[model samples]
Target: MKKESKTDWPRINAMRDEDIDLSESPELNETFFKDAVVWPAQKKQITLRLDPDVLDFFKSQGKGYQTAINKVLRRYVEAQKHH
Candidate 1:
């Protein structure tokens, strides 16, 4: 069974822009935008096949299994470069 949300969505949706308080928030200035640098991750998506047992072992460790696999692969590649 799905759990019910406790939030009052109707009341939140009915609120006007002026009704929200922004006193505690910081104001963004031109200097902030000018100094900002954009660094994008050049990741490519691909489908890979793994043996069931190997896949299960990574999944058993819980979240970030793909990242863990990537780290292992990266270390292997680095070792190969040194050889």
Candidate 2:
């Protein structure tokens, strides 16, 4: 069963930029972007069957469920390589 969110999203969306506090937030400068590394991971498409409950568990995580599933499988593959 899908759970309902108790968050007041509409009210939060209506808030102005100035109304939000950012005093503790760090400012990202050119140095930060310069040090950033990008990984262009290639993906291949394939059909895979999963149990209803297993599929539902991933789907319940909201958006990017397929990507989340891929991450889990990727970790499993990496762990097996170490054995």
Candidate 3:
């Protein structure tokens, strides 16, 4: 799966000088990484392949066509996936 961690790089770099040794503390590591995990905003980009008809239909919707396509696809995935 393709995934990304959302990190505030400047903040992380700043912490490097803060006299706290992250490697020495599991809790610190968890907390640091946890803060960097993003609940993706609707702004994130996703990449997927689609049949020509499906792509053309969404593209015909004008602006924000990708969002519409994703909405349709997200519902489809949620409905079909098995736990």
Candidate 4:
């Protein structure tokens, strides 16, 4: 028996042949580097307690669970910064 894997997102592959309109789109060349790269994270790691139910909820999303959690945390941080 073997586990199943998900198919890759076609848009990403299709991006290779995409006829991007650089003049119309502001974000096309927004990044500093032209090459594909992972953006840097502004926050540092710290251990914190979370309810079992909350952890289970994000884990069920299958992938990018940590990214979801970080997004929530980042929203909170951004709100606090403006106060």
Top candidate (TM-score): 2
> Which segments of candidate 4 are over 4 A away from where they belong?
1-24, 27-47
Q: Residue pairs in steric clash, candidate 2?
A: none
Q: Candidate 2 residues 1-83, lDDT tens each? A: 38998989999999999999999876788987776545557788999999999999999999999999988987797689878
lDDT per residue, candidate 1, 1-83, as tens digits?
39998989999999999998899876678987775545448767899999999999999999999989877887797689879
Q: How accurate locally is residue 71 in candidate 3, as Cα lDDT from 0 to 100?
A: 75
1-83: candidate 3 lDDT, tens digit per residue: 27676887677777745666668655656768866535456566667888999889889989999879767867687678743
Clash pairs (backbone) in predicted model 4: none
- How accurate locally, in lDDT, is each candidate? 0.85, 0.88, 0.74, 0.75
- Show how many residue pairs clash in every candidate, following the order shown: 0, 0, 0, 0
Model 2 TM-score (2 dp): 0.51
The most accurate candidate by lDDT is 2
Give, for candidate 3, the lowest lDDT window spanning 10 residues. Answer: 34-43
Candidate 3 regions with alpha-carbon error over 4 angstroms: 1-47, 81-83
lDDT of 4 by residue, 1-83 (tens): 28665756575567654565567544655463554445566767789789999999999998999889988986798689878
Indicate the residue-level lDDT of 32 in model 3: 83
Error of 4 at 50 (Å): 1.8
